[model samples]
Target chain A: MIDPIDLQLIVAIQEGLPIVARPYKIIAGQLDLEEQEIIERLSRLKQQGLIKRLGVIVKHRRLGYQSNAMVVFDMPDKLVKQKGEQISQLAFINLCYLRPRRGELWPYNLFCMIHGKSRELVLQQLTQLIDSCALNDYPYDILFSTRCFKQRGAIYSIDK
Target chain B: MLSILHKQLLNNFQQEFPLSPRPFQDIANILGVSEDEVLSAYRELDKLQFISRIGPVIQPNYIGLSTLIAMQVPGEQLSAVASIVNHFPEVNHNYEREHLFNLWFVLIADDEHHLQTVITGIEGKTGIKTMQLPLLEDYFINLGFQLDLEDNHQSESVCT
Candidate 1:
């Protein structure tokens, strides 16, 4: 289990690691710990699956991926796992996961995000995904993002 | 247009950030630059909002509970409704989608009770029913897109 110090460190760097020559050294100074200690603790957090990956977050829209669509699929529970693997491997699909279906209201059990240069291209890729995965019978809807309201890293605090 | 350093940084550092005492130094060595140059480039990229952060992208539903909630808001009240949802810190990502369930957001909380409470609070404040869809499975998690800088720049120049 992560102790208080490690939890605090995780919270501290959730926004980002310092963009300095010696980022750990800077973080270590601020946290009143040794730079090596900070690195070891971070490695531990990552090993424990608390920290997923240490990487850079790219702005996809600025990179020319203009079209973004959240596609929801109503697939059988037995087939979801089998088909989800196939669907997620498609080049256009970036995010694919199984989400619980809301009865009588929303019946989509599978969700995937496809991004492309245009809506038509995204739709074409979706068609390709559907045909290749043999998911023609499943009912689905494409919800294209119209506007981004809020996008920020999830901040974790000690208190609820 | 992506500069030589920008292209190299974006392509190389998106995944394998060195787990060392001085990661920027390692990058500097790879790209044949001074560590200070690497640091400034990172700062510039961040300042320009080309990258949101350089840190761990924690996996969802690991330490806490998270749900995708959608709301149907009238066109006139979108701003008001969005502001109400955005007021909560738990709502990390909020977006307007082209569907009857137009407004969608992801809420993360410490636990199930906390998650439910936030959803309830949103319902009370916005007077809109939220369709809760929590993840049941993950097929693909982080599929980072590598930008084709050449094509992207060429297209932008043509458009402009």
Candidate 2:
């Protein structure tokens, strides 16, 4: 459980982490604690695997990359584990997962995403993988992202 | 103060930052700037992204509540479909990845059943099958990024 002080520190960090000489130090200053305390808390959180990362969020569309596709492949239940592993290993796969197919309304079993500079390039890569897997026999669909509403990381707090 | 070069360095921080102490300094050294500058630059970047970040991008499972809902929309009913999905604020993420199940969104419902009920309700109203994939397990890192870039998931983990 987070005490009030920790919660306050968390709130400030959630609002924004400082950017400079020593970020934790700056955060600590805001929270009225020592930098070491902030660092120590983060370390503990890391050990518990609560906090995930500290990094940058880059804008992709503005960078002029052309295409993105949601490639759904129909792999047999038996081969799903093997194929999913293989797909996940590829460098270009930003996101990949397998979901059970629904009633006739939907029939695709596995879903994976491949990204590249353009739709053509992404499609070319998709063709190679689809053909190589001989996955044409199974039913599937491809839906490219038309819009994005929220793409930032999920913010969390102890209070529900 | 951050120089233009340091800002450029933040542009290159990427999804996976190399693990090291004085990590920002390491970046500064590579970019020909002082550690202080790199530190400050990170703050500015965090402010822009609306979260604190650095190291260990936590898997979605770590914070709990995750599900994927895919709905097939009649070509003409797309707007209505989106409005229905948008009704629930828990639908933190809505996307248009390429596929026949054209509309995909992440629903952070109170639980798995809640996620299913919403999808089912949508399907009942629209008559198209809605595939609800409650994340079974997470081993693959799937997050959309940009041209030659993967989005940085390092937001502050108020995971306490």
Candidate 3:
């Protein structure tokens, strides 16, 4: 668990970093902490694997990646780790994970996201992924997103 | 249309962004452009909604608990159900996908208890059962996207 001050720092920057000459310094002013402290804490947090990345957050759809599909596969439990690692290394696949199967309601255990400029392009990439990964035997589903109701960064409550 | 500098900035700086007092300046030095040029380009990118923000993408389940949830809602009641789910700050990403369990969303909370409470509250409000798919393993190392700017087409609005 992180300390209170570190948690406060996460809360401050979770939304975004100010786009300025000295963004960290600006955050330092807000938290009444030294600029170096903010930088050091962020570095440590990043090294500790709490922070995945620190950079530009591109809106893929705006960049013409309109075709987004969540492709899920029902793989043998033993092969999940190996298959997940192989599928994730592909350049087209953005995110991959292993999730629990909800019995008959949901049987998919492996999931990955692919975004492309068109549906045709996405499907073609999916075909390539299947061929390359030798995943013909697994039952999979492609759930293309129809609409986005809401999208934003996660907000963690500091009160807790 | 994106300028060369704009494309470079978008493609190259997706991750490992300069963490310093004058990060824009640092980026400027690397790109062989003036600091003002880099700053203005980023501002333009933000205004155009090409980039969401400059911030740390926290690793999942690090600072708080989160899970992927899927709910099967009646076709007509989809909007209403989504609105109810969106009311909670814990629900960050909510989407309508092409599947029986159509509404897929992500919920993040300060702890496991809070996470369960939000899930129950959503079910209570919408009167629909939600299948929680918590992450069992993350196979992908999220090295931010290497955007292909040249292939990008003008995006048509997908949001209702």
Candidate 3 CAPRI grade: medium
**If both were scored by TM-score, which would come out higher, candidate 1 or candidate 3?**
3
User: Individual DockQ of the candidates?
Assistant: 0.55, 0.29, 0.78
Q: Is the docking of candidate 2 incorrect, acceptable, medium or high quality?
A: acceptable
Ranking by TM-score: 3, 1, 2
Q: What is the lDDT of residue A85 in candidate 3?
A: 99
Off by more than 4 A, model 2: A1-16, A26-34, A40-53, A131-138, B1-12, B15-23, B36-56, B97-100, B113-130, B141-160
lDDT of 1 by residue, A19-126 (tens): 977888888898899999998988877777677677787776766777789999999999999999988788778888999988866888999998787799899988
Q: Whole-model lDDT for model 1 versus the true structure?
A: 0.83
Q: By the DockQ metric, which is better: model 1 or model 3?
A: 3
2 or 3: which has the higher TM-score? 3
Predicted structure 1: clash tally: 0
Error of 1 at B116 (Å): 1.6
Per-residue error (Å), model 3, residue A54: 0.6
